[model samples]
Target: MTDENGWDMSASAWVIAQGENGDFTRQFVLDPVIDAWLAGRSFASALDVGCGEGRFCRRLKARHGIVAVTGIDPTEPLLATARAKDPAGDYRLASAENLPFEDHRFDLTVSYLTLIDIPDIERAIAEMARVTAPGGTLLIANLNPFITASGGTAWVKDDSGAKRFVKVDRYLQEHSDWQAWRGIRILNHHRPLSRYMTLLLAAGLRLTRFDEPPAIGGPTEARAAYNRVPYAHVMEWTKA
Candidate 1:
């Protein structure tokens, strides 16, 4: 989880500017994560891993009335931002491969667009399934690999941005069904669609639902860039 690349994960410039300039991208989260969770049913406690600034976690609390919520991430700076928003919910500095919690402690576990960044995705997912209480939901989300493979045009504009994008694509291209994701230097495990499904099944999770949120969760131009590939996708399953 140590991002040696020194990517500016320090409260994503997007998130920071939103906070400072009062233009957070939080609203976009509603269409996919919160709304999707509520559509299923209310759960007692939930945990969000890779919880950038805990923005979505806080929204889940406020929007769905989930009483117990926690957010964990390896990024200390981001965790600090999450803490500032909701001091009540537990916030931990941790990695997905080895969470700092007891087995089966949470009713639901989720990560937002984070799996692609994880170096050890299978282990991380195994941990996710391992920590979920039986019958509890485990949600995995990422940008569609097909989008990247099909030349979905969501590239970052500078060297800093290109590095982040390349690091992710390098690992993901291995499982790329979409064709365009096959370049070398891909450091991420951005599995293709089938891999996502296969891993969930292998982890003993019963498939429940999948979501491909509309146009980057909204049609706005700024967000549209990310959505250029196909906004968001969620794979839901219950531990069995």
Candidate 2:
């Protein structure tokens, strides 16, 4: 019924297909975020925003049995794939800016490498805190837009399976809002971790810790690879 609707469907399908073989996207930067998650003491319920194809959902489900993991995304095919892969997983096809749940419905909110791709990140962050009960944690693994390594954009590989890549500057353009295109294109807003901290704090959250994942992929053949991890930031905060 809207522009985002179709785009969401396409985005979801693209991710589902990407994960059909293996979780290509999540693998790119799972370590830094997972470490933060494992550090959490507990949670009664969890919500994952921009939950692309349930990569983080599966991990959450396995870590916390029947923890009432709810994944919300605007992509239909991605939700379907997530639903099919984890039959018991709960999902809602909705935009990140507007979630379809009552306030304080979740004990925790987890988003991985999702903030940068989202056009309305401020609204999304607000919605995340809204769904989280006070004192609950919000763990986000947003793009350090300034990371020198590389984004998870796909690349070609060598005959020997060595990984190589290109920056893929125009990757998120079609998916972003025209007004926000400048920021996304140039990664101007998503710069240093301090910026994210300011945004999170403005949303009425308290910053906890930050982590950057180490790059440990290849050095043998040199070919197209995926999600070159130059650097990333892992954030932990509480809804205050």
Candidate 3:
């Protein structure tokens, strides 16, 4: 099945996996960095591109006091769940490649761990830049390119079943791989880090901050494992 279909099929499981606190990476790694960057800043409106289940949208409002938060995703089942959870929230059925909104409409735009799911990343990044108001921020959290390039077989474990190192190949190649775990199956696209950097820079966005954050808190073992090979990075950009 197509990745889109897979998301539709696994919507329930996905929602369950991301309970109230979110998964380990989100709870410990991404959220802290996001919150720190957003601290003391207020925006009237925000857009969460590929916002599954409206998690970050709610976070923006509840934590940051953002008044108008909109979330868009291609998966209807996910949108349905989002709307069900936040009945008054503006959750739209849309894809990142073609956002259903006016140009420069949002004060702050976000793409949290969703870039890998986008097939036409160039168009999607352009669309994201187009909809972001001048001076508005485009914050993104994504899996590290090395982790994606590893194709889910990143760890090389020793005889004692301890990870020795990460195995990565074809780092310059762009491809897709099927990933299945915890009752969810999906296809994620992999691109060289240079590809993402070049595209974002060409989109007329200026990079304000970049980070490969380590886990701040979680299970001792899990956090230590993640810190050994940090799998995610965050980039904050602004449209000029």
Instruction: Give the TM-score (vs. native) of candidate 2.
Output: 0.70
* TM-score, per-candidate, Cα-based: 0.74, 0.70, 0.97
- Sorted on lDDT, best first, the list reads 3, 1, 2
RMSD of each: 6.7, 6.5, 1.3
Clash numbers, per candidate: 7, 6, 0
- Misplaced by over 4 Å in model 3 are 1-5
Q: Among these predicted structures, which one has the highest TM-score? A: 3
Order of candidate numbers by TM-score, starting with the best: 3, 1, 2
Task: For candidate 2, give the lDDT.
Answer: 0.64
Q: Which window of ten consecutive residues has the lowest lDDT sum in model 3?
A: 1-10
Candidate lDDT scores, in order, read: 0.67, 0.64, 0.94
Model 2 misplaced regions, further than 4 Å: 1-13, 16-25, 32-36, 147-195, 216-229
In model 1, the Cα lDDT at residue 62 comes to 80
Candidate 1, residues 1-240: lDDT per residue as tens digits?
554523333346635544531331334642445475667588898989888677768766886788888888877877887788777878898888899889999998887667776777788888988889999988766766754443434444585554233212443455422212212122344467676677778999998877666543444665655444444577778898
Write the number of the candidate with greater TM-score, choosing between 1 and 3. Answer: 3
